[model samples]
Target chain A: MLGYTITQWLFGILSFLAIMFALMVVFTRNPVNSVLYLVLTFFCIAGHYLLLNAQFLAVVHIVVYAGAIMVLFLFIIMLMNLNADTEPRKHIVTRVIAGVVGGVLLFVVVGALKGAEQLQIVQGGASQIGLVKNLGKVLFSEFLFPFEIASILLLAALVGAIMIGKRDTNINLK
Target chain B: MTAFIIYKAIMCAAVFLLSLGVAAYATLWERKFAAFLQDRKGPSRAGPGGIFQPLADGVKMFMKEEIIPNVSNRSLFIIGPCLFMVTAVMTSVVIPWAKPMMVGGHMYDLQITDINIGTIYLLGVVSIGVYGIMIGGWASNNKFALLGAVRASSQMISYEIAMGIALIALIISSGGSLSLKDIIEGQDKGFANIVWQPLGFLIFFICALAETNRAPFDLPECETELVGGYHTEYSSMKLGLFLFAEYINMFISSAIMAGFYFGGYNFPFSSELYASLGLQEGDWLISLIGFGAYFTKIVLFICLFMWVRWTLPRFRYDQLMNLGWKTLLPLSLFNLALTVVVEYFRGNIHF
Candidate 1:
């Protein structure tokens, strides 16, 4: 029954790809390659959102993460001229410790998720509720204050970053 | 169900091929239009008034030697143009090309798919188009190409803000729905949205020009300065792909502009004429006229693109940035506020 529907198939494939890309994002030696892998992971998650019928979230996730944020990351990585040759190899003990810690983290996550298969997932979660009109109504009516606060927080962060980055160097001689 | 799927498959193929053909012919038209503006004959030797020029040009692109620089990243260099072409083609998916077609007592929607978040999908696809230029420029490992890529991504990213804001005003006017079909139908019930969204249209047109990298905002690939810009190192079909993608973008942008602002195929007097002819809706005759009307809108906008290209000088890069950030951004925000206030007064908004 779980394998019969297209949605279940898509979720399986996308989740597999997402996890694979997430691993690749960390394991890739080249920063640009890592960024590209992260982009793929973002796209996979966006596909999962679309599978859940959250089209708005899917598009916004792509627009914000893959389109903008990852592009910025790639820009910085490219500007820094990073490549395999430039990468500093980590110490063997450090790598071993990281492997152990990562293994433990995976174990805990897998343990936590072991029972998830037993839980019944809805085939569709009220598609109309996920549409833009109802979402907008819900956001504005119930979550209006939180949305406004989030905007103000982002605005403050943007201004602070600008202020921190701006310099007043006036000592150039031609 | 299979028939329905087959119909959609046909519509997809038709839209894809239509975009490709339109982009090819648009190149020929651009040259011819330029000739008209400058009082010269342009490529008449190929066919009647150079009608076969695009075909000839395409053959040449295929026949030319494909060159990849030794220093360049080989796979990415190959992938760049392909991605550019793919993104260019993808934007057309959200644009509804025609009204429903009736065949064998079944109504088949003439569009490929009418996704709910059509405008957002379009904007997302367009925003990602920057990657094609960025990767192409970067993979070339050429300084000029890298600079061109940087300029492309920055320009597209900046202009997209204004473009999004301008479209927000349209969305407000359309009463918060992002479906292009609904918006076009809404305009059909009234005057074309251009009447009410004139400022939005102005900002939108300017931003569209910027987004497509057309003059006077064509700094990304401006030939004189960058020597072919991002595609400087590319040759043969790769270069053709890069260049062809621009015309495709132009065609799609025109279709978008027509769909959003000019009421798409909702030509003024067509319905009256159809009523006078005693033909019901979804008749083949009406569909033909409506299809012609939609293409007319697209062709007119395409001509406007050519007109501006031939007329206006390219802007300096700084001037381009300044216009995008200082002028268009603030103007679009003002348009947004104005629209909100007006809609409030018109009682289109509750609370």
Candidate 2:
């Protein structure tokens, strides 16, 4: 047997699960099922974050992706009443394009992994970086500019959403 | 390591049993409390003052017939209630029941696990809780159930934003530690968070009501409109699980409110009493007294929940959404700013 601590074994299992569920998200015929599978994939990713001792990241991942975003996706699908019977079939040309796009994405990922291998892998030591206090200090001090920029970007997106959602007063008056 | 694992296992079992037991009694109490409000006796036949009512109810639920619609998705349909119950039980793990107790030479925390991001963990678990109602309602393949599920998910999502903001305000005033233990200790040293963050507490309280699907905000299971709502197609223990999870959620949220705002497990004159008794810190007896105080606070909160449930009428769906987004959200933001201002002036927080 290969030498592996419980943590390593758990990491391997979670990685496998993440990939499997990601595949399930694509393969599932029903839209609701697809969304639920994606949620499982998110949970697996969150598990990976926990294994890294990024406790804040892990919980936030669950809260945002698995909890909020996926629920919205499921909500939309449920509202639409989409099912396997109602799923529109793709043309052969469209399927071919999708396949090609997926292949290119996989290639890019593999290339990234190859590059990542050259970088030093910090393994097997508990780091305080994941704790909220350290994370807040880092974000506030060193990464202050990027963090504020991100907040501004989010505010802009919020304004855009509200504008899109608003009705035309002129049309309503008429 | 072995001893630690064994201790943790025991803690898990204890917490699991405690939640379930509390949830069971909560059901009986809800009925009896409702009876008290309406000026009638409730379930008096089971035992003296209906003490065995929950037990009887449990037996009835277990003995009843369970049905799964032929058209429904079997797996998701079955998984729904189990998921609901699991998440309900999972929340109690992070709650510090009392001060750490000294047993033999070791200090053992009453909490199951004291993760650093305890508050966010609760939020995450609560956010995931909507899935149980959603899946159950959808998997029923019935129109009423589907409508219920839709209402549930939307309501939970809307209220959660305000709830998180309210929590952020409280966390700011209570020294920015996400751990419940630290929050409680901060209260022990000074005033409970409620004194400082009353607005935040009110917002959090309202949001908790909405989050738990308690009445006045229980649109998800509104019977007059959508007959039986989310559990329309459920039968026997499957339905029981959904109801049970609701009570457990109420209990856990009560405990959280106690910890976050009400100085959990800390009573006035506690130190003086301990000193007079010749008991040192971390004494088991001291922890037990603190637990009794904490339990009293939680029970009071639970009764308050019941009181509101009986008194107030449910809001219209539009009204609920408007209150959550238009009212609570802005109020929570204002509270956050107010808390920040106060903390800075007090020199507790540095810009």
Candidate 3:
């Protein structure tokens, strides 16, 4: 029970941390700083996943998002020479439009929250569904089609990416 | 409860101190190893057989002045080395050092925690390890540092996939458990994993060499190209820390390789040794003996690491990338497929 209480406290602290880092990801002016903040946010979310007894999900999230993707983000930001404090200023009209879009999104989110359903808390062994064996079984059996489709979509995206990333060299005229 | 807590604390201190101590000596060993390879005298003035060279090196590092460049981000410059050292230290946790020992009739494990998903945890932390170099190099704001950082990040990212895939093959071959203790114990029961997963071991070893930034794969900090690489702007103990973390990383990686492929603390004649002595397995006596064998294996690995370092020249960056992505990655996947096919043929694999 003491350990359980500590876990709850940790979850609360980590949720707050995740939100703060998420905000920092947007607010940071430096692209590298923003990417680092985003990585911190990913780690905080990984902590939340761990708190939910989803160890595999937490680790995979770290490995893929924080580890690989954010490192690439840092790499790209560095290679493009984007670290200088030289962000172009937005036009007044553009800022106003962005503000309006943000306001609308916030309102929509709040309105949806007004009709939120009651929380369904399952008893013992519910969290065990996050274990690798159980998760894999569910993915293969119940969610097989969706899983296959998602992978196929990812494969198509990968191929499209290669095509996009390829340099267009002009051929010599014979 | 107090005893358990005390034991855990002691184990933590022991593992930490052991890693630092071994890292210190590994530096001396590396020097001596290089000298032996090159047929020259190496640090004979420090102590007998250069045994005290690490201590002298430590003192020298401490005495050096700490420097912060005017353009460098001060806070991040400091955090970079500290983060690198912390990640390097943390990786030793999942490795089971020896068999469980008996203390006052309570069985005490030499390992910190035998958690499930240990290898995944290692992968995750290792992925995060790139941040230290990235932050340090970026904070330096120097072109060489930046290039080095970029190289380090890309190199780690490329190698980690192959490393993880190779590990997955091992996991499949070793009954699909993600725990190191299970892997090692299973290995101890039979021959080492090198028997079944030789190709996997080779792939893992190469990836490990790349991962630890050892020679041939030392492109990130190659002196000729990048001028000390990511630590170009770093000075004093901060520099010491980055260097320390590398050696510490080498030690941990070697230890892990031993555990996963070399039967951990188990020797081939360990059971026979026990039988001759009329002692049971899993006893503290056996545990101590196993620890002795484990230490020997670790020393041999450290030697191997140093030997390879002195023997091979550093790889060019593009060549490193090609080896990682084209060669090792596919080879690991093929090994995984071969494992699956064999397991299916052996009638152990199920859908």
lDDT of 1 by residue, B6-58 (tens): 88889899999999999999999999999999999888989887889999999
**Residue B197 CA error for candidate 2 (Å)?**
1.0
Kindly give the stretch of ten consecutive residues in candidate 1 chain B with the minimal lDDT sum: B219-228
- Top lDDT model: 2
Comparing candidate 1 with candidate 2, which one achieves the higher lDDT? Answer: 2
Query: What is the Å distance of residue B330 in model 2 from its true position?
Result: 0.6
lDDT of 2 by residue, A55-120 (tens): 888899999998888898888888889999998999999999999999999999998788676788
TM-scores, all candidates, are 0.96, 0.96, 0.94
lDDT of 3 by residue, B1-351 (tens): 999889889989999999999999899888887787889888888877777899999999999998899988788888889989999998988888888887777788889998788999999889989999988998897989988888887898899999999999898888888999999999777779888899999999999898899988987667765687899999889999999999999989989999998999998977888899987645778888888888889889888888888888888888999999999999999999998898788675898
In order, candidate lDDTs are: 0.89, 0.90, 0.88
- Which TM-score value belongs to model 2? 0.96
- Using Cα atoms, each model's DockQ against the true complex is 0.81, 0.89, 0.82
Give the range of the ten consecutive residues with the poorest summed lDDT in model 2 chain B. Answer: B219-228
lDDT ranking, best first: 2, 1, 3
TM-score of chain B of each: 0.98, 0.98, 0.98
Per-residue lDDT of B1-351 in model 2, one digit per residue for the tens? 998999899999998998889889999999999999999998899999899999999999999998999999899999999998898888998999988988778999999999878999999999999899899989999998999888877888999999999999988899889998889988886689999999999999999999999989987667777586889999999999998899999999999999999999987777788899999988989888999999999999999999999999999889999999999999999999999999999888976
- What is the C-alpha interface RMSD of model 3? 0.7
